[model samples]
Target: MAPHTRYTRLAEEALSPAHSVIATSQTYDGAAPFPDFPDDDRPAPARSGGERLQVAVTALIVTLPFLALGLAAWLLWGTLIRPTDALLALALYVITGLGVTVGFHRGLTHGGYRAGRPVRIVLAVAGSMSFQGDVIGWVATHRRHHAFTDRPGDPHSPYRYGTHLRGQLRGLAHSHVGWLFRNDPTPVERYAPDLLADRDIRAVSRAFPALCVLTLALPFALGWAIGGTWLHATTALLWAGLVRIALLHHVTWSVNSLCHVVGRRPFRTRRHDRATNLWPLALLSFGESWHNLHHAEPTSARHGVDRGQIDPSAAVIRLLERLGLVRDVRWPSPDRIATHRT
Candidate 1:
């Protein structure tokens, strides 16, 4: 993490390690360090009235679609999931999933490959559409994750509680989504000094709010043009906009929770990383399921270093490399794979 930007301090302090940092600015907004985790100067700000309203709106957006789908299924014996809706949602999922895995994780956070200006802006904007957070903050939290892994300071480790079933369950919840609401923002300056120096990152960070609206509005417009009706637009908003975002959220969160608790670890990573390969999540997670290898070799472009492990994000990077859109590729080698292989 870079330590250049000065962040604002918060009055109250807590010890929770959160996965998501509050996207207040391109600069790293931090408070004084807590005693629990060293290099833990992250600060989560108090919820403002606008933030509270956004939360309420988000809840409503997620709820109403399910209710409508359920009611239609029960009362009218109708299928709420239309072919177009499914197609749109799937498309959005893949696009935004690549944005997070290929763009945010591999490109920005790990420097698995180097991309040109256009690629960087596109990836950052696409990633922001996933509603994860600003790129700099996301990178900051992720770098912190790599720095700590499953140790005490990890942003969202499933082993934070204990080995017991009760503790595991608590830890899983905390890792999956609980920590997002409960914890404070990470100190970006400490984690992402490189990004702060780039004006490109600052522009993308500032466009976050607009990117969010574009994510939803683009789908709605597509639906309206295709179906030529407000009804189709509504359906698109529900399926492609809200449902896709929520599902991706949980899938990304699952890497923090389920991947840590379940799945097979094929690589010898840092002690106690507990990251694993959940094959079921490979497709949806866009190859992020190869968490063990990711932990073992943080800078490697490809996480699925072995045969038959589908890594879509790596494929994208490979294509971009071929097109000269990305350079300084970090694709894993035979020696690198053997060293990490269990």
Candidate 2:
């Protein structure tokens, strides 16, 4: 059977229905999810023209900013750093970062809540602006990660190498960014057939290229309009466009690399699930560093359940819930919290 078919048969019962509340923590184990394609290890196909174009543009976007920032730092000695441009980049970073945290991770992949069509579109576009992979692909890969975690099939596990000094360094590199160059592509059909089946989500996935162009161009245009100079446009592109994405990307990826191999496991989970809570990263990672609780209560609307663990993303979700933009939130219950607590 195809991956989707297998997933439907295996995961249908496991998945909480749209907007349904999961009352207990036992669902994750019961719903083992669509198993990885153990027998289907055929070589994947090459990238299409659009994919190649995206790769080229993404590379340019990722590189030119550093060069610009470096030259400005050398020649202008930090004088070129505009307050507005820096603030613009920070604003976009928060918006797009939360888009990934709330929309892509919890709302889509884990089904922690449901949003209306307008809210969904906004979230998708904001996530795309971050220049992460399109929503469809991102959701697929992340869902696969939750299903396998530190086990063999995880796309980017820091523990892939044994825990030794040299091995850990190599694993950190692999988990951080080295996995991008690998040939393996997570099969979307098996992991994210639900998202693929959604017309709105499919449309957003199809618009990733256009969204990338808009995101970069928006900052440049804003700078030019606001400051009225080619230099200001370049500066905006450097800080807000390129730097913002790079910063957010590293922070998000740190959850995969740093959170797993370090920090305190304050919650119980599966036997081999080595995810941990890295408090230092809580603020920057937008609450995603609480990986131990996340793994234990995959559907909980809040990851930072502890008294003082600040979860900005969860706060945003709560604000939206108050505004009636998102509904059926799966906030952790007292019993569920007690069950997972170490």
Which candidate comes out best when scored by TM-score?
Answer: 2
lDDT of 1: 0.74
TM-score of model 2 (CA atoms) = 0.84
- Full-model lDDT for every candidate: 0.74, 0.77
Candidate 2 residue-pair clash tally:
0
Count residue pairs with overlapping backbones in model 1.
Answer: 8
Identify the candidate with maximal lDDT. 2
**Runs with alpha carbons beyond 4 Å of true place in candidate 2:** 1-72, 75-80
Model 1 agreement with the true structure over 179-267: per-residue lDDT tens digits: 66543456777677677877998899888878888989988998998889998887887788877887888899999999987889888
Error of 1 at 200 (Å): 1.2
Off by over 4 Å in 1: 1-77
**lDDT per residue, candidate 2, 185-276, as tens digits?**
77788677777878998999999989988888989999999899998898888788877877788888899899888899989987668899
| TM-score of each predicted structure versus truth | 0.82, 0.84
Estimate candidate 2's alpha-carbon lDDT, on a 0 to 1 scale. 0.77
